[model samples]
Target: MKQLLILCCLCFLSAATLAQATWIWYPGDYEIWLSNRMQNRRTDRGTFFPVFWKMDSHYPLMDFHKDVTLSEPEQVRIYAEGTYNVKLDGQPFEGTPTVITIPAGKHRINVKVFSQATVPAIYIQGNKIISDSSWLVTYEDKEWIDETGKTSDITATKWLHAGSWNFNDPAILPSAFTLPVKPMAAVKTENGLIDFGKETFGYVKLNGIKGKGKITLYYGESKEEAMSDKGAVNVDWLTFDKAVSQDSTLPASKAFRYVRMVTAGDIHIDNVSMLYEYADVNEPGSFRCSDDELNQIYDVAKYTFHLNTREFFIDGIKRDRWVWSGDAYQSYLMNYYLFFDKGTVLRTIYALRGKDPVTSHINTIMDYTFYWFLGVYDYYMYTGDRTFIKEIYPRMQPLMDYCLGRRDKDGLMEGQVGDWIFIDWADGLSKKGPLSFEQLLFCRSLETMSLCADIAGNQPDAEKYRLLAADLKAKLFRIYWNDQKQALVHSTVNDDVTRYANMFAIFFDYFNAQQKEAVKHTVLLNDSIQHITTPYMRFYELEALCAMHEQSYVLKEIKNYWGGMLRLGATTFWEEYDPHESGPAHYAMYGREFGKSLCHAWGASPIYLLGKYYLGVKPTAPGYATYVVEPALGGLQWMEGTVPTPAGNISLHVSTKEMKITTAGGNGILRFGSSTRPTCTTGTIQQTKDNWYELSLSPGSTYVINYQSVK
Candidate 1:
């Protein structure tokens, strides 16, 4: 009995230690430093390529502190990066102490550190005292000392909750983090040509390489591009002077499935392999349906999204791995449905909004700036992390202030010098004046600011922004709404009717029922309007239809558009897919032979659409505290899937004859339409609409219903 008691106490102590000890740094500093290392890694044909926009660095100095009340005296082990000092209850130690003893009762511990090349971070652990996010951190300067030299003058400074991630082991530093990689071999090998059989991103490995010679590998998403020296967009040129045979691997990672190898002199490689590098994230949500082709599209889209999800959600793995707000906005929605990885979403938001004096719009694009705000709005609704909203509110105000400062006399946003008003990548799209689309986004951002301001406890600013948003929304309709076109015009300067603003207004809830019906016929379904070719915009276009209860029509668009790319042998979705182009012409864009990215993040919107619309699981309240599930078969024989929330997963299985659902948490309503009266296993069913019925759901109960399909 004595031995068992001792073992139990030891296990409890170990668990407590594990729970409390974690490395931490200034909030968002490690994310910025990590992204700096990841973004500068892009290489174009062996020439160094970096982002054109300004990049920010981590704070060189950081102060971390923790105040605790202890019942017994204890000692803590200290670990940190760079030169540091320790303080105990406002008293300085002789030097930085690896182990320090604390007295019983209340006391405070402070660690100050500085490092120019990396973020200053620390880890502390003990039997009872441990470093964790409960600690506070700041980067303010407090060097002004009193005449005594021991006492110091303090200035007003703000401290935030320290930031940390999965770096729990002290042996592994945060700055040394890297994605794990695994070895893979070619599926097919020919004379100087190799194919991995599908699209992949990794470093090339040459096995049994020897002698001194020149070797070059041309990478391609398609077979033809790899064989053409002039057309290949990515290449590896290596010079060797080795006397013995040994395996060699390239330094930089590239995206490719096929590689055409060329060598000069006596270079010889017996075999070829690759090291596939990928982000580690959990896929908590899933989807399946009766249609095999739609299932395949969802699978490929998930792959495409995972490829672009790296240190930050990037545009593509092949080129410009830098985070773009517009691309990441779509990725965040897709991630909520698939991975539900909160770390990636937060990291991408931090990396894009860097530490700002409000320099330029995120990615230097006007529309991208608004998308960042929109992403924040969605992040809160899905996760309901009020702490994150409070932390980011400071950055939000300044960015909004910058936007407000740029407005013209009309209180409207217009393209200014050095501002790129990028709405889409179409050929004839105009950016010449105060765009209706920009105004729409700006108004939405203001509304987001108002919501966040209320959450952050800034009631004055919240009311101010609410009124600002209301005024801009009214101006938007007056300036851009055209009765004849039944759509919002493209711009005030041209007064041209376009689909951009009208389609956005539908899902944004800016249009009335009568206006939405009119615009759907005259602008969305109208053939004369310039057709959308890029999957980026197609994401929203299809979403507009889905929001209007046109999931059946949107399903066909998904088949013809995303399915069209799959029919073209796309292992991963493309940056843009236009069914008009054929052969090598499908790969050409921006005047370069292979400038277009074959695997892009925004191309993966089916994950969001199917999970949210077809499955019809959405949060009517923050964090799924209250949610509604209204499944749409959309002509499918059967469909089933799960949608993730902070609470847990909401799973649903639906078919023509029956419907079933199980929720992890939240008060939910299972809604459906049955031409014949529906019967449920449990719960009271009430007819909510002419053909629709609603069933209240509790968290742990599994509700099954038998119903006949309507429509």
Candidate 2:
């Protein structure tokens, strides 16, 4: 009777543990597998179009194990994909038993699975042990025996914490994972053309359709492209011999604002709608200002971000839905100020840095490789996930070593035969010689590695990378910084003073105060310098401007550029925007009729700019343990925003007459400039200069101060 009671208690405990059980696989295995599936889903002109780079798959066979201690015997239920075997204390279980009994005391459980079609994964639930990230997983293929016919020490075998993406349900296999979708009707349909009223991504839903012969739907980001055959970037075709009289949705999701439906023979169409598929990410960060135009820009930017944010942070919804490292880097920064979706950020990072033999740069772009490293740096700074840093460090070292080995005689990174020096999509852009931009990003990446190494407890490599970064930073200045030009020249061979390197240097803090001012005058604000037409590079250009306290000027530029797109009836932001171009010409890029992605992820820069620069809330310490909030009105009458942090949300409202702030949970220092002395009863105030004042704050404090804004 006592044993029965104990078993009942153990059963209850095991049920509780089962709630936490989730399917687990080797880290980065499922990510690479899912990314390959997503990247290859792209199609152009009714034909499949995939990424040029090599796609990696998950390991077919995997071994997962865990050692546990229990005060009493407990029952464990096991579930897994693929054929598998179980072992307890070196004794193999007969066949594959789903239910097993473990005796009291210490025991090690092991599950081996083989799945060629998808990632081999497992789930186990017991009183104290469950399949989760705590379990170690490996794909070690080698084994050796001693002279005594006993297995040798397996210490050399590589094992890592199993990866789990919150798949708590045992029935919902990771291989069958798909995003949620909902029905969406078109806003208008005129003359067989359907418009969703804004840029959207989903499968086209045919309602009440009885079709025969061929049916074609051309998708486009603009109205003109949907109506023209050669202009539309995506198309779907279907054929029916007899009227089926049923609702049918397209197989793949596509990006489109307008769709031109063409039918042949007995095909009949009642209405046009869609099943909109979207990522479910939270929007904890928000912004509202007196300027209506800027508010619209923020809303549209948010929508753009939502479209690009899927299982991974992709570049865009339309063309090239592939995860580009450079694009994902910008998305990560914007995410810090918006969704704060650390999981999505981590997934994108892992997918980009796949299982590495260190063959080539990420996305085959030199700058993109560095961007991936920088993404890791920012991820730690924002989320304070030290475990991820340590987990990814082994791969980081090899990737960085691959980069270090690719240097020229002077320890500079020059474009190699296979490397694509894709700084931006600009015409007449030179891609020869050792580019200053690559070196600048490379130096930043090295510094990131040093910081990550410290977090990962690699002291020797940390110092080595630190010194290497320092030497490279010094070399970059010596080789590229032309004192007369007051800007980092574009490349060693061309020596053109472009905005890419110079603007990046300012915000990177690689340049001094005098150098920042000089670059601002010569490159950033210089009219003679070739202008940056793409939103990709413009993100950095604007960030550099904002970093220099040029918020007022940057605000005007934002209005002139992003607001300019809004003025032209843009439902969502574009990959590239030029005031000089108009109508259908604005939609053209890469020598194609409609190659530009209208709703690009990088187009959502206002979210980052307004949150960090204008509202002026940023972390002084990692994970917002300490942060600084320096609100800049930037010619606005009023502005209020909430910046998401790992702890909580930091809310702020600013006007010429008053300022209000409520910290989420951090040591905050609020800095502002006043025309006159400001008075506050909420906190202690210190005057740093003639106009600037600083106020100290603690966690969860709501402070209201009466102040006059300084011009």
- The segments of candidate 2 whose C-alpha lies over 4 angstroms from its true place after superposition are 1-19, 141-155, 242-244
Error of 2 at 410 (Å): 0.6
TM-score computed on alpha carbons, candidate 1: 0.96
Clashes of 1: 0
Tens-digit lDDT track for model 1 on 526-572? Answer: 98999999999999998898888888899999999999999999999
lDDT of 1: 0.90
| Error in Å for residue 386 of model 2 | 0.3
lDDT of 2 by residue, 1-711 (tens): 999999999988756655478999999888988999999998889788989876777899998989999899988898998999999998999988999999999999999999999999998887567898999888974554332334577655566889989898888899999999999999999988999999999989987788577888999899988998877989887886645677878888999999999988887877989999999889999999999989999999999999999999999898899999999999999999999999899889889998768798899989999999999998888888899988898789889999999999999999898999999988788988999999999999999999988887778879999999999999999999998888899899977888898888898899998999988898888899999988898899999999999988998999999999989889899999989987889988888988888999999999999999988998888888888998988999999989999888988889889999999887989999998889899888899988999999899889998999987
TM-score of each: 0.96, 0.96
**Model 1, residue 566: displacement in angstroms?**
1.0
Model-by-model lDDT, in order? 0.90, 0.90
